[model samples]
Target: MIEKAEGTFESVMRAVRGVTRAVAAQVDDLVQRPDVLVVEFGVELSAQAGAVVTAAGASAQLKISLTWNK
Candidate 1:
């Protein structure tokens, strides 16, 4: 995982610097419990290398959980 700010910035730039991207995302579903909530999303990222890119492909999909002490 990219832990530092500089590394994170570079990671993002590397994906975008030389590629064309069509990005889409949707929240597909969620689960709720007494103490927490979780949500999952579907994401589609279509990437094609531009003239400056040698080879590149990228997509991101993730789920998040939120919780609070009662």
Candidate 2:
């Protein structure tokens, strides 16, 4: 159906936009809709060579929603 195709196109567009934003942004915290808030964060932690390492130097954040919304 045409509606299904339109929906798919919109979904693809939204995903592309999200990817573009994630790449072009450092900190992304915004409200997705009236009842939903999407916060995407990426961080990099660099530890001194002599210090203990808790994580890798690079991190990639993904889209996540809080439990309260559910």
- lDDT of predicted model 2: 0.51
lDDT of 1 by residue, 5-59 (tens): 3454566566553332212122223233335545454434333544222233445
TM-score of 2: 0.36
TM-score each candidate. 0.27, 0.36
For each candidate in the order shown, give its overall lDDT on alpha carbons.
0.42, 0.51
Over 1-70, each residue of candidate 2 has an lDDT whose tens digit, in order, gives: 4564455556556765787676445333533332444656454445457544432243455665533443
Tally clashes: model 1. Answer: 0
Q: What clash pairs does model 1 have?
A: none
